[model samples]
Target: MPISHQKALPSPIRVVLLNKPFQVLCQFNDEQGRQTLADFIHEPDIYAAGRLDRDSEGLLLLTNHGPLQHRLAEPSQKMPKTYWAQVEGDITEQALQQLQHGVQLKDGLTRPAKSQKIAPPKLWERNPPVRFRQNIPTSWLSLTITEGRNRQVRRMTAAVGFPTLRLIRVQIGPWKLTSLQPGESRDISGDPQIATLLKSPKRKSYRSPRSPQR
Candidate 1:
């Protein structure tokens, strides 16, 4: 029998949604002996879509599909990425408004962000926790922004005089970080979120997506 000429339907994209833990590099391999995505994920070939800093934790997506990765990783995509930031000192209404209106940074002015004080989200504890400052109280805030700048959340808080003590990404596009414990990851297939990643948010900006940390 002759081999059929019809091409098989493309296999569903392999998408890995990882709740990355603090202190782990976003990349799969690191030469500095630091922990990396490889420590938690042994899957081969797939690369991280966007970066989560070594000090930051939560929702980090990985995949081998280049176009899918580009859609999520591209700065032009304007996909809103949300974060929960535990900032030093109680956040003031003025500060929250400043954040919502956007603050001036060395990189210029950030696009307006969706920000509101939020109750501390129930989350896993970091191995080495943030310092306990008895004199200064901390508060949590949820922030959503369409631009991915370098240490943007931390910078935004600090710009408003609220230094971020801990940061965790809670969502990207339509995908939330719900229920996934630190360092846990799962395969996501055929979800509407995959389509949502490519859509742009309401605003526009020239800031590039966060580059992989060295």
Candidate 2:
């Protein structure tokens, strides 16, 4: 028998969940001297799976695995992402219904979303905190959707007549932000089931049965 060599498989992917802070860009580098992921994450090779706008805050996932990144970031995958939004008014049921049913924006009508009014979440104070309007009351909302259009969440709420004062992503697919504080991160590569979840067939929706109470 002739001797033969077999190629070894690459190491398992590394996934880092970050609690992105307000005003930090989702990218690693910037030319305008703005704050970016580089300021927080010192790890090499890992890239953000998806983006959280500079003005937005909270959970962000980074991975060194290209296929895994594509799986999570691709809009067609319909990986649900949940957010906690503080809006400009005492949100009404009609507005929540509009959000749940679908709201029309300049881009187009959004797909039906999971939307509900929630009590204000206990969170670290934001620098240059959301402007306080004594006469205008603000309300919190939990919104989940399966798309990644630019500023989609903000636009959706505005279309429903409530402008978002603050936005924080709380979950993505099977991952949760948990108790991570701003600029903190936790590596989840050791979780045995994560590979199974990532390699599973694409799902129409991947939201949790019960939303996390932050």
- Which candidate comes out best when scored by lDDT? 2
Give the per-residue lDDT digits (tens) of candidate 2, residues 1-214: 9877989989678999999999999999999999999999999999999899999999999999988898888777888999999999999999999999988776567889999999999999999799968899999999999888889899999998999999999999889999999999999988765677676898564333232221
Root-mean-square deviation of each candidate, in angstroms? Answer: 3.8, 6.0
**TM-scores of the candidates in the order shown:** 0.87, 0.89
Q: Rate the local accuracy (lDDT) of all candidates.
A: 0.86, 0.90
Q: Positional deviation of 69 in candidate 1, in angstroms?
A: 0.6
After superposing candidate 2 on the true structure, give the runs of residues whose Cα lies further than 4 Å from its correct spot. 1-9, 203-214
Q: What is the lDDT of residue 165 in candidate 2?
A: 96
| Residue 92 displacement (Å), model 1 | 0.4
lDDT of 1: 0.86
Q: How many backbone clashes does candidate 2 have?
A: 0
Clashing residue pairs, candidate 1? none
